[model samples]
Target: MLFAAGCLAILLGITHSILGEVLVFKRLRENSIIPNLTGHKFNLRQIRILWVSWHLVTLFGWALGILLFLLADVNNAPATLITQLKQVIAIAMCGGATLVLLGTKAKHPGWIVLLSIAILVWFT
Candidate 1:
């Protein structure tokens, strides 16, 4: 169940990224959807639901990965390498979340933040 949940979360990030890429972004920026954050009053409250959802997914995935790594058999060089790789991936995800929370996007850091958290959790 937990493994499935982790996969679902990674899928969610992909979905969200695609949707944001297509739907949320302004046509002018081409790939970037961010608006004028410097002048406008960014509404954190409006986007809170998405932010939290992503956060939970990330946290759970990360925690699970860490737990599994600690418990998994690492007798072989490959197994140890895989565990190390997952930890690195998890750390990257955490880094992504940090970027978002640090105000990467005032409008839709939702997808970015959530996906970051999820990916980090899964690999970690």
Candidate 2:
């Protein structure tokens, strides 16, 4: 179960990096999506800062996923407690993502499925 979780975390990290750093940021810089959405124009510097900050946060998330993977492999009591805490955090995050996506009328079945699997894994 931990191995499966680790694999999923790595996969998610890669997918998130590509989506945020490559696709989303590229389009934001090249298009009018931001101004169109906000009804206000931002200077190039501000846009660049936002872009960099976004990537930084994405990278941090990736790091956290990797940490979770590593921590999951530990075989001590303290490590087990930490792993369970991490699992709880993951469950909350996944649940929140699922709710937000569904509330926005976006496709969220994947997150729901992930949440379910994580719950099962956590208990086992």
Which candidate wins on lDDT? Answer: 2
Candidate 1 worst ten-residue window by lDDT: 30-39
lDDT per residue as tens, model 1, 1-124: 5445555655665676556536643332323233322213335443343443444455555555544444453454777657765665566556556535543344446547656665856755
Candidate 1 lDDT for residue 13: 57
Q: RMSD per prediction, one decimal? A: 8.3, 9.9
Question: What lDDT does model 1 reach?
Answer: 0.50
* Candidate 1 lDDT for residue 76: 41
- Which regions of candidate 2 are displaced past 4 Å? 27-40, 75-124
Q: What is the TM-score of each candidate against the true structure?
A: 0.37, 0.42
Residue 118 Cα positional deviation in candidate 2, in Å, after optimal superposition: 31
